[model samples]
Target: AQRVTQPEKLLSVFKGAPVELKCNYSYSGSPELFWYVQYSRQRLQLLLRHISRESIKGFTADLNKGETSFHLKKPFAQEEDSAMYYCAPPFYGGATNKLIFGTGTLLAVQP
Candidate 1:
């Protein structure tokens, strides 16, 4: 079974401060990790993927295979950056492009 874990349910940070959201996973096979974000009243969108090595909205996440982790980080936080973040891994069954998400972390950036 593949599992993604986001230990923090809520995180608050002041504007301009750096932020890091912790994530861990347990999977026997090679994992495909992704970060998904949902803004207020908006649909969830892909933030980044381990395979892409791309950064979005000043946020970046690196998949650490050794640690079984993919922690998201940003050097500076903005009020606009506040959102619900989820760590997701592909479903084990290999059915379509579906993803199983971890309990998300709600990020609140105080102005």
Candidate 2:
């Protein structure tokens, strides 16, 4: 089945360090990628989506179809950025659209 992969389970970095959250996907059609984030005790919410080509909270992800990847990146890390980050693609199942999310990578920003 088509899926998204987040290779790292935990990514720890000191404040001001550059951060990258890896995400790779496999799909047959033109895919829509999303980065979802869950802060501590908070619900998962959309961080960014590929089609809009937008950046959220100083983070950006570019779709590279040739590489089948949409890796999330930031120029620097901050304590507030600590959270669980998921890579996802919309799954068209029957009449409904569902999201298939990666196992998620926890970003820990150490001060």
Candidate 3:
């Protein structure tokens, strides 16, 4: 079973606070990991890729094969960064290239 699960439906926090977005996946074979973020009234964009090992908007994610998890974390939250975060696994071998996303985590930043 290839599935992506995001336990939290929503995550709200004050500005400047640390945020951790949990993600778990189940797959038989090796899968590619990605973090997609959509700001308020904005289109979805790629936040980071596990293979690249890079951080975007002060957010970073590490793929844990042992635990089958890819959690997104940020040291501090920003009001402007408030958006919907989705963890996705892209289809390999260029097979229509669909991204299997979790339900999604709505991050609210309070002033």
TM-score per candidate, in order? 0.94, 0.97, 0.93
Candidate 3 residue-wise lDDT, 9-94, digit = tens:
89999999999999999987777899999988899999998999988889999989999999999999999878999999987655
Q: After superposition, which runs of candidate 2 have C-alpha atoms over 4 Å from their true positions? A: none
lDDT of each: 0.92, 0.96, 0.91
Best by lDDT: 2
lDDT by residue for model 1 (2-60), tens: 67899999999999999999999998777888999999999999899988888888899
State each model's C-alpha RMSD to the native. 1.2, 0.8, 1.3
For candidate 1, the per-residue lDDT at 45 reads 95
Overall local distance difference test of candidate 2: 0.96
Clash pairs for candidate 1: none
Better of 1 and 2 by TM-score: 2
Q: List the pairs of residues colliding in candidate 2.
A: none
Q: Which regions in candidate 3 have their CA more than 4 angstroms from the true location?
A: 93-95
What is the lDDT, from 0 to 100, of the residue 44 in candidate 1?
93
Worst 10 residues of 1 by lDDT: 89-98
lDDT of 1 at 81: 91
Predicted model with the maximum TM-score: 2
